[model samples]
Target: MTDEFASLNHFNGARDTPMPQDRLRAIRHGAEALREQLLDDPPVHFARSFDLLRIPYPAWFAFTGVYSQQLLKPHMVHLLARMAVVQYDDFEGRLRTLLFTPADFEAGNETPYFKRLAEKTPKFLHKAIAPVYNTVPQALASCGISPAQVDYITYDHLHTQDLRRWLGTPGLLPNARLLVHRQELASVRGLLPVQAEWYCPHGLDGIAAERIVPFDGSIQLGRGLALVHTPGHTEGNHSLVYRTGDGLRVSSENGVSADSWAPLSSRHDGIRRYAKATGAEVILNGNTQEGSTDQYLSMVLERTLAGTSSSHGFSNVVPSAECSPHWLFPGAPTSHLWGETSFGTPLHA
Candidate 1:
């Protein structure tokens, strides 16, 4: 594929333009609103027979989408550091844990991806949110769960992840296995320089190859949860769909903010006009590996899978990198929203 439409390399196009003056203010306002929502509401919740916990990771900043840092100002877009844990009942009615975007996957300087990024890049524009950075253990503890309690753990993709951190030398979560897409595992085995530094070549180093549980495509993990294939962000990118109390919800990095996923809410002047005219979608997530076509289709698939969402005309697919402070720079830090629900009320964590 040509880098023009499918690449994670830093963009440096001369085609630059300033967003409306009101855009920045709007972004700040959104950040504050989301942050407040998270503070007021707890991250965990019960939906039917399942428990969902929205885990906040360290905040980070990086140019998002195609034009974010490459073609336009490096400060137009941002992503929040959000992850989730799902507690569901198996066919036998036994409670099982399924972690999405596990803490060991991304964020923090201790990670191989960030270490290399710090050494190789100049814009090392990321910050560890000391308040929430590496707080997954605490979050898990609050719910009376631990790594040993976890049945399965998965990330949408393995971009910035180093499995060794979680699996350890002989293996840490002895009872748990890393659920990953076969295609993604293949990609990780052969890292390309053009890809983001978030993916560490030695990530799976210590773990025995058998420890990695690979799947071919979309799957129904259980009655209440599923891992749907949506390969646009990467060949192995997937979305998590769950049956909430009210309806269905999805989680993926395919789209960053709700605005990116909610076409109805993305009616701002510049963005609206551009989206309508060019037939090209822009700034959906921090990473743009495949193309708008695949990403857009993935978005559509999320809604289709949702079937009946508590939301009106939109699917509930929350992105982890959401606390973006700027619109031009997708990686800039700002605020956070644990998870938006039309799905159901969150359980306290």
Candidate 2:
């Protein structure tokens, strides 16, 4: 990975390299510097520009709690799933096409961990709680993109993801390959007890090694896009960074909503009090507190990288699964909903 676009901090090395507190300070400084650098001088924009397609899917109510520290009203959240279509010129000047976060909603339901929750839910409310919105491929087609045009596929992390249908046995996208973090691939191979529940047991079973592109740290794809390693949600979790017309935006599952990173400005009940009491700047997604401190720092990195959004009160770190306000979820309103956004021209058009 190039030093210019790579993560300012990494936890892959020796345990407690400098201790969590010390590392946090270093990351904070690095993030601020990078933010200023980007402001002073932005990176080259993508050749044909990039496009984003966001689709909402139903997610459990209690799981979207702020920091998962406190409980909110019990209701479902419309989790927004994003599909970023990027076209850029490589070093060799070859035009490359990437399909980021083409998540399979049907396959995702098979996760053993979520299955346990489904089994416990009353049968009458099953369809209401988890309804089908649209598949990734379907969403792509709506935007005039075909499956064959996808050159690469990736996600912030592989939680509840089943790649067998996409890259493994079924061969859904003929020319597409998976770009994943080395540590993330390892974690999927040998599941950790805490993270195992969210992953499908046989997700990557038949995928050939050649179909996956594994790398360490962070990597910049051409100019406008970079994948920054922001571990904390999972040992291998990373966030998607891209230059948008609005500004730089980072997408990850680290926090569920804008209220997550900027709790002090949030109108949600108890969130501001919670932040003040704990001296916390950001709220954890809380579903998997695998690395709380690391996640917090990683979020800080994301916040710094994207900077703040004038439209909203917090940084432009868009959660892959953003929480949308619902009548059922009365008191737990979201600060913003980046719903079904489109930027640049359609790839197929």
Candidate 3:
């Protein structure tokens, strides 16, 4: 299935070419076909999610409902940044390793946007968030894997990421190549006003072009791992699709929880009602409404590709930034939180 969906790659590029409903119908068919093909003979050796840290986010942006009644309050929700590890074979049939969303939290804080956000945080609250933070190296060590073992590094999007430390001078993953969407790489260099807040000023500066693998549309790295262009969260945002023992899992920051994909089944306030009232299949993580319609359709594509969780009714769309139940936001608890998942054997003995 490597190049089977080549024509459907970068579908977001032509959003105006087709009606949204028409585009959505087409996306469903493509996603369903891809899901069936990939699951039959998954080549993934191991896959799992690692906890990084939690940060405060506006409830309105996390779950934009039809009614703005509860959205206007001074409400905030906690979102957990996570990393995913997947090992598989390359086209040459040699085993390789990939790290998705392995964000360097310490380096990320240097961004003026987040740095200011941190400065405004109350001292006690800052201390609370500090305990949950984990570095990329620390997360790797927890899994008994080394930085040198990583062959590729990628993310669902470049938001809040500073890749200089990972791919620039004296990088941590010496042998790893950064896989990024061509548009995302360009967007980082020249950010729009709305995009600047979530991006690092010098994130991609000085990294040798050869060290980055920029791609358009969707591409499968190997048998079980594929990156599908699910734009709308950002113009170049793509979702990580990989096969697991259970089924296929799609990871991205497009939504914060399973509830974001299955809003009708959500227990959060107004979300379920809003879905029913508006006939919405998925809710947007409305922080960046740059392309709300496309984002909605992208979520639909993610849902179709992920199928459904046998244990949970919602699709197995693992959000990169998941909403966890916390004392910080009691009213906005997620019905389903994919804390961690590990399959097959560890990459290193």
The residue-by-residue lDDT of candidate 2 on 1-349, one tens digit each, is 4322334343334135568777877777766655554444343333121222222233332233343555354444555555666665444545566776767766776887668767888889776665556666776666676778777888888988888778865687877888899889999999878788788778888788888888787776655676778888888888877766667777888887887888787777667777777777887776677777888889878887888888656778777776765544444457666665555655442
For lDDT, the strongest prediction is: 3
TM-score of each: 0.68, 0.85, 0.93
Model 2 residue 13 lDDT? 44
Question: What range of 10 consecutive residues in model 2 has the weakest lDDT sum?
Answer: 47-56
The worst-scoring run of ten residues by lDDT in candidate 1 lies at: 2-11
RMSD of 3: 2.7
**Model 2 misplaced stretches (Cα beyond 4 Å):** 1-19, 36-71, 75-78, 122-124
Per-residue lDDT, model 2, residue 298, is 91
Best prediction by TM-score:
3
Per-model C-alpha lDDT, please?
0.52, 0.68, 0.81
TM-score, cand. 3 vs. native: 0.93
| lDDT, residue 275, candidate 2 | 76
lDDT (tens digit, per residue) of candidate 3 on 1-349: 2242232353444455457787788778778888887788565998877888887787888877633645223377789888988888766777788999988777788766668878988878875754466778887888788889998999988888888888888899898888888888888878888788888778888899888988888887877788998888888899999888888889998998888899888876577777877899997888777688888888998999999987979889989998786675666558887887777876782
Cα lDDT tens digits for candidate 1, 1-349: 2111111111112012255224333333432332232233222233312122222222212223324314333333334455577765554545667777765534335445447545654443334322234455655665566668777778898776666656766555667778888898888877676564557556777687666778765565544666766766787888776665544566777766554555333533433444565554334553445554455556555544444234344445566555344333344322223342233332332
Count clashing residue pairs per candidate: 25, 0, 1
The list of candidate 1 runs beyond 4 A from truth reads 1-76, 105-134, 170-172, 279-283, 307-314, 326-349
